[model samples]
Target: MSSDDNAAHMKETKEGLHSDHHVDILHAEVLASSDLMNDAFDGENHEHSQGLWQSVKSHPWACLWAFIMCFTIVMESFDMFLNGNFVALPAFQRRYGVETADGKWEIETKWQSSLFQAGQCGAFVGVFLAGPVTNRLGYRWTTILALVMMNATIFISFFANSLTLLVIGQAFEGVPWGFFIANAPAYASEIVPLALRGACTATLQMSWSIGSIIVAAATYGYNKRDDEWSWRVPLALQWIFPTPLMILIFIAPESPWWLLRRGKKAQALRSIERLGSNSNAEGTQQTLAMMERTVEIEKKLGGEPSLLDLFKGVDRRRTIITCLMYASQNFAGNLIANQATYFFEQAGMTSEFAFQLNLINSCLQFVANALSWPLTAWFGRRTIYLWGTATNITLLMILGICASIPQTNSTNYAQACLGVIISFVFAGTLGPISYTIIAETSSVRLRALSTGVGRAAYYVAEIPMIYLASWMLNPTGGNIAGKCGYVWGGTAVVCFVSAYFFLPELKHRSYREADILFNRKVPARKFKSTVIDVRENE
Candidate 1:
């Protein structure tokens, strides 16, 4: 607040409690002892200007809680990883697929599409369910309920003798995964100081990469077996994540942001206290002031935090940008990249070699994700995402050109090399950074609903795209082979154009500052240079 505003707020506080002389005396004492404008009043402001490591060191407890919540993403990751990679397992194909004229067994492209899409569709429902449920029940209890729902649903897919049962089970299990996707990052973002927000939120993506890394190794180990256990072992592993996460969440602090939204100021304060409680009293109050002011402004601007508010007023731009930011992941070729193991096998590498290459790619993804924490801090979200997408275009163009020529060992190896590079760039840059962008873009009042709606858009885009990917990659389908890179390259161009126009640089901004920038309708290119009074709520 400006000097005038601060004086007015203090005046109003004193006048309201004027009849209570004791209150007035205590308020004066606080004013004399604590300066709201100084570093003591708000540690976040102090940390905001500090470097990344300083921020991390300041909020170690926040980081620990954030990690616990982010770890929930690992459950969703394992399910998704198994959903696609299982098709690449030779024994899995022998167990579930048909023998063709060439005497080779293969799972049909339609089934592959159906299995993954079932999970997508289920996640759509789960995200929608989570938004409202989370608002009422809070992030902690809602996660507990989702755990129960997920474990129960796993049984349906685990023992199924028919593909239909497995598909239904995958869809059912997806509902809980949707809940995890929508809330984990939001919870992480709320608990941390602003300096840690971007990297912490982006860690949701790292947990995902961690999940992929674990399952990749497991699938490679089991891929060589020609028995039912080859696939069943990985499916059984799904149970590992949720049970442990449920136990940890029982003792975790509720998101202060979520509590403040519910108008439980005391509880919000206590939750902040619980989350290592901000270092000092002045810092705690300052944190609450910033969080409270930001939430109140959003509520005023957006009104009552309904799902419809996501598309109204300034929120319209935010909601659309967030949703498309998510959809761009699929557009930039995630669905195609997701089937890399199958892509390699169809392109003529042995199944064992394909798994080996996939394992290497998964490991590289972890390294990229680890670097993204600092890179996100240094380069900013919009810059890195654009760089990642632009690089993918060049790589995909070359891959498409290579695919156009007659098949050769050299061309196959070239396509494999290009595919690994695309995933690596995505993991480090766009993939994880997108998590940061989504959290930053959504208005705090409408954050949970916005995340759900945006993630739901991701699931929706994947539906048709999954079918196209299956047809293009499957031998019995379109057989577009490595030339599929052209399709994703074309879409990456769309991602670049949309990002250039729509995505803004939200780096190093507090939630209040971000809201002010969007409210002013600043141009995307001008975001970094824009200045505001910030003292006035308007």
Candidate 2:
């Protein structure tokens, strides 16, 4: 045959094979969907048709496991909020402060800020370390190891006589902080049914607020004490949450997705059985097939999972969105809100009242976080993020205006009060919801690594903002007062814009569905409405 004729024939043959493959994939999808629907509608076990409450009722054990697992974040919350509370304590200041000419004692502003950021710096290290560790050890063991290390570091801080030692202890405590933050949401997302994913994943934020509230109350109870014991007592209390977490974590099942990736198909199926409400074997089998097929598709698209793979192709966009989502938590005035105790005290509220106010703010935040579960389940991540960002920006700008006014004692109190309320809104809405977005955005194979990298961005973003917060609010620093709000207000504007443009809604999307959507490069706005056939698309 002529060379041209042979080439044309070969091209036609390739097209015919491609067309046949497409037809076969579509045929398979139709068959799988038919089976899935039949299983979902089967007699008494129609989990797919059930609401969240019904699902919970049907799978009480699985729901309980998810709840217990989320409680681990309370320890993370305590560690995160402890520095903010302690930095505002007069007794803590007196213990660490240098005596001045007027017989007053003051902790150095640089140390005050750096001590808080020091833990975050350690968190940065832990965040990177958590990815590989979780990949190898799975979530349960990684968490146990992290909890042990966290307890050890907290004890070191509780005994330390020097600020340097205390800072080191805080830094080490952060290592576990990184581990928990990286793994907790990933774990929750994996174990919970898709119907409950929003509410369940949001427990990460809710638990953090619960932890913050406990510490705030602890600090309030100790604030009036005139010795080192005041701070020491609260620091010691860090051990409370982890003891139960370590015990409970042992009983929790490994993520089925993780097991499936590691080729433990039987264990993976058993995990699905334990965690899923779908009572029929057919339903579980369908889910397992979806998972396996999705993983296969991901393998084709991205080779094998690695740290470097997070930054390639569609994953690069996912990484950026995830990182920015985490960064948005801090940038959306989280640092300023976190330092509410210090800011209130600086504005002339008595130390006890400041702590009391902080306690109230924590309560408000806890309520807000609880509210977020329903809100997130109803509205999804992007809407909450955009709305929350706008709310925080307006509140911060108003606070800046209030702070910029000439200081009247009443106005100072007013600014502090307003700032606390604004912070509560931000915490309930943006702060915890960001974790959900990160968890949902990542590919299953790279979830730990993506979440770790995203969380590491959170700490990295906090570095400058922490110092800036110290300067703006500290008496010895720029003491920008409410003007710090202006800076964070501007940041919130940036966050709002980025989230509106880049953050896609993944409210009801399964991991495989999310993969297909990202693979197709769907516009952010279209995610909610776009229908994808995961089996056929591959």
Candidate 3:
């Protein structure tokens, strides 16, 4: 048969797989593709090759949307770091005790640490509750709920008389925190077209760096203040930052994917039109066909797959690898570098030197992430993961050894600075790339459930991290640096093995294609070859 006939036959055969449950998959892809056509795919790219930088820079609205949605993610990062590090900032300053030179509250007390943990505890509950809520109520409501709750957390934090009250407020904040983190990227992914998805999603990471810098700046600015009010202002502003976002997103387009999943075809079409600029009708039609097929498949499969289903079949491997990947990423030790500036002081550096070290680390992460942008485009996903995981392992070992050394007041700050730089290098490549892997490799039938599970692992992973570090950092123990390094080094080893054995390259595969890959019945260790290797016949 001729190629045209072969193409038609393949299409026909694929169409047959669009049974009931398969419809959800088909619709989501179509909606995603349509959203991309309007928001991401460029028909013009077919005719002319555009330089990568030029292509990205020219897409202002896409960039703007990315920046906007990522702002909340960024705020969350800022809060996470600020909350994490606030414990280390001198309790006199962390609590509302001291006043600033300008007569503002500087910070005070050990209770603030608990208040910070309170936020995470709230986050745990919020994260758990967000899934069903989003499923029932939609991403918009979740976003709104989080924004309101975050604002309340900040405002209540200002008035919190005791740690108990602060925890209560953080609990409220955590609810939305969980909601926003869970749904924001999914919502953001739906808004952009496919070609731009990688770039846009990767850019969300930039927000974390931005948040780190902002919190650092805020903390630094308030450092001179002798009062409790200094840090509170910045913490309060976290909620304020998202009020506008909540308003804007509520008025913005709902996920066409979500609409299609809920069997709202007309609404889905209308949602796509609103997302596009009227030049996207052809793209819209293509997207609609893709979504319609996806919806049909889901319907045939008898509706949404249960959480248990995510653990069955090839999806089981995908689920396991995904968990490992996310777990590795979180455990890689950047959180310590990112938040524990005060620990540097305990590590033999002065407070000024410690802050400077953190400054260098954050800057390097920005630079590293920027460098990786083009590299990610030229390289495939699996290659990046392998290289990044390996590189990170090496850097982490170097950090572990450096941290194990005894530093004096006269120790070389420059060497310490080098450790900070390597930390960023690890984060720049490993940090963002791991998220990409987790998001890409999972089966669509289990994406949301898997994502939530991965995120929960992330938060839960913190318990051991905090416990070990706290024990090691005890003034009498002097093992903080050593223990921190050991934990990360171990994680690196796991990552290297996981990548070698289990990870499948997801480059260029559609969501449906991924499903086909999982169903191929290849052993987990051989996944990459059977599905993605695609070497010519021997």
Candidate 4:
């Protein structure tokens, strides 16, 4: 055929194939050099026909991976908040007298009371150890070790008698909670489709809210029972939820990136194939390229991140911003959720009403979490954060105002209920959104470390507030609501300043793209000026 005729025929042929078939030529080109498509299709240039979700399910191994991941996250969330709804158990025991000395409250010396705080102390240790351990041991082993430690700790905690042993057990249990905190986000990010990564990343946080609801319901059911099993029942039930899931985690596929880092290319290909990929070839290619970039950047950065990197470098602002965000999250005062029963009692609500309030908060949290999924996507991260902060600030102020007014027999309780509703709304939105940002903000090399730092800050801020401030807020004949409001108002100021100055707008940015945006040598407030992306370059 003539050269002109052949060229015309080829153009028509390409257009015809494009119209007749769903596959993009560019996608095929991107997959050409990769191992993911090998043997799964027919010819040298054949396209993989399965839909994204279809591919996800068809790969038994990938489905198992996502399931195991989701399960671990769900259980961790459940475990993390076990103490949230049961402050009343110890408080009730203290109020009603549980083996106390003359004129001195001895509940502080009990295993049950100590268990409440020990888990958080353990989490602090876990957070400190996670980065080094994960880097050295690999994600799978880190996860496995954490699960083993957590399960063992849970079982041992049930058998403890003295407050000391309970604290030891709870602290030891923090090891795994730390492991989950450090690794789950990285693990989930590596496993799921980039398109769905945000949703899946938020999955654990959603499950956390759900788990809180579950624990609240259980606490409500067992609140008044005098049996030793009443507390044991709730504690022991942790095994029922996590043990089988631990076994599943053991068998789930190792992180594809982790495997790739070890030069296990064949295994990595098999891993992603089973795990889902974006249907567009460009996105998959982009992911693979980003993974390559992660390794390159890690090498160039030289050695693990130093403490100064979190404080003085281009990355320093990110660290500060994450810390501030985390602090705000904890400072919003979750004590109300955990110790709501006590807070209510101090505020003149009865024990029965306190439990009912706890149940209501848990339910509202679940609904609010469901609402956040759409809201976060519809409004950018920045907008949701601002909205949540404003909402929380307004709620806290109103609660403070209400508390200052004095609740006499003639006062309406509806305003008090309104304050409780506001607390629930604040948690549902900012609580999860802050977590989502922490996991996504930094580069892969620094993600776990940053997460560890942020969690440490979160717990440090959290425990003290819950234990001390909440304690003070409940002072006899004090403005309990106003005190709580003042604490949250301080948090709101931090949230507003941090959002405006330090935090970047990261919506729709890829991991590598985020790395570039954050690595730029500019103040965080000026990040938009230095932000770089391929689209902008083009």
Clashes of each: 0, 0, 48, 1
Top model by TM-score, which number?
A: 1
How high is the lDDT of residue 189 in model 4?
62
Model 3 spans > 4 angstroms off: 1-63, 91-116, 276-278, 405-415, 474-478, 522-538
Q: What would the TM-scores of all predictions be? A: 0.92, 0.89, 0.80, 0.79
For each candidate in turn, give its C-alpha RMSD to the true structure in angstroms: 4.6, 8.0, 7.2, 7.8
lDDT of 2 at 483: 83
Which TM-score value belongs to model 4?
Answer: 0.79
Query: Model 2 clash pairs?
Result: none
Candidate 3, residue 291: lDDT: 48
Candidate 3 vs candidate 4: the TM-score winner is 3
lDDT of each: 0.81, 0.79, 0.60, 0.60
Q: List, residue by residue over 31-82, the lDDT tens digit for candidate 4.
A: 3323323321221111123333543453445445654665565555565556
What TM-score does structure 2 among the candidates reach? 0.89
